[model samples]
Target: MAEMIKEPIENYGLSSKDRKKTLFSKIGIVGCGKEGSKIATVAATAGIEVVFLEISDDRIQQAFDRIGSELDMRIATWGLTESEKKTILGRIKGTLTFAAFKNCDFVIEAVRYDDNGERSLNHRKEIFHELENILAEDAIIATNASSVVITELASELKYKERCVCLHFVMMQPQSRILEIVRGLYTSDSCYNKVCQFAKLIGYDFVTVEESAGLISNRLFFILLNEACAILQEGLTTPIEIDSIIKVGLGQRQGVFCMADQMGIEKIVPQMEDLYKEFGSLKYKPSPLLLRLNRAKRWGVSTRIGFYEYDEEGNRIINENEKK
Candidate 1:
């Protein structure tokens, strides 16, 4: 069945008071990949117009499809109605041109990692320049990276004070918490606006110092690396390790399972970045991760990583595994 479209509230029927002030009225997202799609959905769900840039027409359609599928999942779970999905979808627009970003109150640069899991700093800085040229001087520009790219990207901008970084938590649309990074050049007004934007989207923000891997990725890399080492040393199976983390540590998912969800492809490059920044062996990507990434096994995205998965992304158990 074709999805119905509804007129978004932001597009019409606003009172004179609402017309007087605009608070993040429009958000532009560069690179509508896995992470970008989620951010777009969140902002659009909050009734903000979301203009997302994709590389091509097909990629733009794919991003819309991904967002629709996620909404369908919520509909299936009774979290959203069909009408609400239509409203949210109506608020999102996909484009190939940065010209669509003009006049955007808030813009997020969320470039995806390449197939090899590497993202170039120079390329990201170029995107920063691109956004700065289009957005207003007071508009905020943020990157959706956990690494230390924010400060350097900000430094290249004419309005360096308006640049900040935000790291959305993995694995959910409604994650309540967001990690906010303030660059050295980021102004107090910019940081405060980002925090206000977070609250507008129903997320609480945490301030993190400028560092490679920021807060979540730094701690998560260590936990995932230790888990990988345990698997390498033959101390436990992937399933068992996950079980211990779930049952013993009371985590929602085991470290390995979450790693798979986040993609080994993305994780490995971040580990390399962190290692280069801090020169710590603990931040190094485990041998197992590199092997899997080299083999092109990108976890749930590819249906293979630490564990095999079927087409539906459900893990397939081995015959020898104990129930």
Candidate 2:
């Protein structure tokens, strides 16, 4: 005989309705550009709710299109189902006001660069203050900053302890590791929570002291500059150098190729920031980068950089390699 069910209906719904809420169930992103879009996609893929703020409706639509296209590529390469893509896209929303982030557990500032190819620190600081006023005291405020220090951004916040640095490397998204930096006022609780956030989104985390460039930029910049120096010395073509690095050293992408993807205009300013911070020649921008920046060949966004690209952002390979 079949056993009679004795459990109440509430018992079945207990885990569904009464379970403890997740720490980062909902997150807010200040900008939805390349960096912000990557973070939004990652969080949404992990079943987290995401709301990103854009300057206008057009930008919001552009972000959605960019995210949708990225998901399409994943569908082709990673066997992600179209249904899964819809689910991921469904979890994300875009807004035009900071008030929309009122309920977000974590808010990350990833604003895009201005026309001058630089992000304004004043604007970021203002964003932090705006978020603090709207967000709960317990909610965290973070920046996807590379060269800027977290302490400076957190200095003006009422809840400075909640502000931290969370840098994501856009180059190697498959092996992307998070570099987390704790500010002068970052509490132990805040830092630990960020570490949990990293794991929640399927990333490995490294605890870093407050510093400009953190781990990713400081190391990557030197490698890139040295590679540029070799090119300057008439050593070899970019293809040859990339071949040796990829085949011999097992690098994921050629140094110059990575720079192109990163945008020469942005790289020069960041290099200058590092150089100013460390007072070292190693942190200085390469002359080649300066030339590219001056000429407005700012990488895939412009379809040109150290190498040329087609409209689809695929680098065009010519039989005669031209710098």
Candidate 3:
């Protein structure tokens, strides 16, 4: 018998020529906490591969659990299918080392905020150094931090032109707006590429000056503070106030409800930062928020904030409201 003729693997299998080539194809996230995991899931759902780094295996697993739970909620609402969820989850990978980010052309640092809702600038600077050592010179570096000025972080890096800030207001998934801030040293090419990235992940982008709270948080925190003041004055309840905002102002949700979604712990600190930056009393965190933060009723993550939520994160309806 004649020997079998050699064949090209691409011909026998999927053709290499058919493979899609795109920038932002693979990205990395330095932290897999709440915001980090949300972006990871969103990117994976958009068909981009994601690699998220955590400090330990347990933390990585926790991030995975959180992402899965979010997808389950979408599935329950008919927004996602089981197979699509599987595919999205399959595209995300967790790691304990920055080395995993070496191949990522774009990496976002979405680390958890401390009790005060702030990440130490020194700590973030160190993270930038580690990423710079691993990634290519032209790779884009970004932070999902609304308060920290991108200019401050960029000043710490050798490739200062590659640094930018993307404040993702993840109050609701459908709230697909991204506040993209370019640092003083950020190059125009880097800014344009990041805009493309926002588009890739199915987000609309807004150019913002390097301010502590960008646009959304500045407006949101002030509105939330006023609502708290009204409650303190005994003028209205949270539910009633929410109704006014939703029905009257046409906001998708009330400020109190949106705050619960934002988590009290995260809210207080960011507000504190704004107050500290601008020295404005309006940006000061409300007493109610401080109490909630102290009590650790951190929104849906803890299943409670202004309202209570069930295991699936759905708010439990009060019996009185049932009438």
Candidate 4:
């Protein structure tokens, strides 16, 4: 039997201080949506060449524009020098084809549910197959999926050993914690490389079993779902619950506020998916969530999730606006 490699965190060589840096210059990011763009920006900032692959020219332009704005924000808020910001922005190139990933040392799939609410696993699988056909054999394939099983996705690929999951927290630039999950067939070398790369990019790495939702989202959504359930049951009002959790638990922000910041539309569907997969009572989507989603109140993006936002994107709460 092959020696079982424990979680990467337990291995000495894979420790943050001991892991070797790779010559990973070029990285390809598929689905330049929210998390995708953030991943691309971080890699680019670290001087890694980035090719952002999306389905359309409009999306490619939108991603580039978003990255540009983010780079500008980092310069102002994080005290990044103008030259440093320029170099970071210069490392990113947007493309509409998977062919651009040919020379990439790593390809990360950031595509999630489509606009039509269809999960695009097959579409992403096709992209992975195409990348495998074109990219170097040594290249690593990664997914940013929050709920999908990395092992299941890896099973469809030719290089299953080289494929793993690199789950980042919601706010990529600010959030330091990253969940690094290894599939059953993931090679030790590939796992080690990814662990090293996580440290290289300055994330606090936590190794998790290849479970759906991993650690952070799994625990987080449970709490969020419970908070939603309480609100739906009329046991407590949003503000009341927020006040209790903040004051009693010493939390900086309330659950609903954090949910609003995370975007309700994004969280609701994932909650539903998790319920379907796990059949856990706690995973059930709250009625309040279902109602809000039906009403198209999708949080900050839609300007009306748990709380309403003004035309200028400032969150506004009016007692009269309560549903």
The clash count for each model shown is 0, 0, 0, 1
lDDT of 4 by residue, 1-323 (tens): 99997776636564557555456778898888777888988888777899988888899898988787777777788768789878887899888787888888888988845543346777777777877887888899998877777888778777889998888887323676678888899899998988888877777888888776777777878887788878778896888888887899877777777777676677777877888888997877778877877787777777888877887556796765486
Return the TM-score for each candidate structure. 0.90, 0.93, 0.91, 0.84
Clashes of 2: 0
In model 4, how many backbone clashes occur?
A: 1
RMSD (Cα, Å) of model 2: 3.5
Candidate 4 deviant stretches above 4 angstroms: 1-22, 116-118, 171-173, 233-237, 243-252, 310-313, 317-323
Q: For model 2, what is the C-alpha lDDT against the true structure? A: 0.90
For each candidate in the order shown, give its overall lDDT on alpha carbons: 0.88, 0.90, 0.89, 0.79
Residue 71 in model 1: shift from native, Å? 0.7
Candidate 2 structure, TM-score to reference: 0.93
Q: Supply the TM-score for candidate 4.
A: 0.84
lDDT of 4 at 79: 67
What's the true lDDT of residue 149 in model 2? Answer: 89
Clashing pairs in 2: none
Model 3, stretches more than 4 Å misplaced?
1-21
| True-structure RMSD, every candidate | 7.9, 3.5, 3.9, 10.0
